[model samples]
Target: MPSPVSDIPAATPDLAAAHYAGKLAFETDCSDVRAAFAAGKVDFVLLDVRSPALFQQAHLPGAINLPHGKMTAHRMAEWAKDTLFVVYCAGPHCNGADKAAFRLAKLGLQAKLMIGGMTGWADEGFAFESQAAAAE
Candidate 1:
């Protein structure tokens, strides 16, 4: 089987170090993600590569919805070149994040996959936000 990170675009030094150090790797433990959020180390964009309806139901707060299919076009204009991106899909088995990460890398954005995705986030009891809800 192909490594999950194989499809991802160029890895930034932080991500590369994380890969070697086993930090910032795609993890099923959402607590780490929450901690990153709490520490303000996650200044990158959080992207939901799921469908519109799924996104409307629930998503990470501050996550920008950029369904995978739209990523190759102008919709990606919402993000800046220097923006670091954390992409997620439905779950670990899902490859949407990998594909999105590849696209982001092709576009020259620094990107990484959240690995465990939303299911992991929900399992960890981390907070979620709806499209209509305001960000904290």
Candidate 2:
């Protein structure tokens, strides 16, 4: 019998390539975000779809705290209609990022989830910013 990892036949190379490429249309990762920041090549808006209190405690630098629940078309209109949003929540354990993405889509805005969220950022040894620091 095939080992568990190989029990199911893998997709053909072409299908696998398409599947992975398709996923990139909706998802990004902490490492890529960091690299964009480091290179000053950020072309998207980064949103923290977490509560105000949690966001005040800690959040990704350059991320704007706009909890998913408050994502209205009016609020989002603050940005240009063509702005691309990248959203993240607390971690993989949370679905706030997904909710935010859904809301953005419903409002006819472009969005992508930053996979792994804050947990992934921490895992990558990234520095975080707090609301207090942002004031200064």
Candidate 3:
């Protein structure tokens, strides 16, 4: 019979370490993102791939709306080509984030998926600002 998965933790330390390293490389948690925003020293741009109406309702402090369905050359042309993008959607239940990441990749832009979407931020009690507020 095969042994239980938990019984082999010590034997797979390298695997665990590599997995964690890879995760950190591809995903970032909200706290680190918030800190970067507050410090005004970020290595990537934040993107929210939701409908304009939803975006207008509320979004991350610095996230710019780039609706997944409307992703196109004309829409993307204004943004810097080399900037790394961190994308999020409504929440984990929403696949808009993954779709947006795929589109960004197709456009040859570097990107990483934020571990949790906006819901994650709200769950952590982070404030969301409306587009109207941002306009001011």
Where does the lowest 10-residue lDDT sum fall in candidate 2?
68-77
Expressed as tens digits, the lDDT of each residue in 64-96 for candidate 2 is: 999999999889989999999999999999999
Evaluate model 1: give its lDDT. Answer: 0.78
Model 3 clash number: 0
Among all candidates shown, the one with the greatest lDDT = 2
In angstroms, give how far residue 46 of model 3 lies from its true place: 0.7
Q: What is the descending TM-score order?
A: 2, 3, 1
What are the models' TM-scores? 0.71, 0.95, 0.86
RMSD of 2: 1.0
Candidate 1 per-residue lDDT, tens place, 1-136, comes to 6578877667899878868766454322356556777888777778899998989889886678888778874767776778777889888889998889889888877777886789888887788888667643
Candidate 2 ranges with C-alpha deviation above 4 Å: none
lDDT of each: 0.78, 0.96, 0.87
lDDT of 2 at 108: 97
Indicate the TM-score of model 1: 0.71
CA shift of 132, model 1, Å? 5.0
Better structure of 1 and 3 per TM-score: 3
Better of 1 and 3 by lDDT: 3
CA shift at 78, candidate 2, in angstroms?
Answer: 1.2
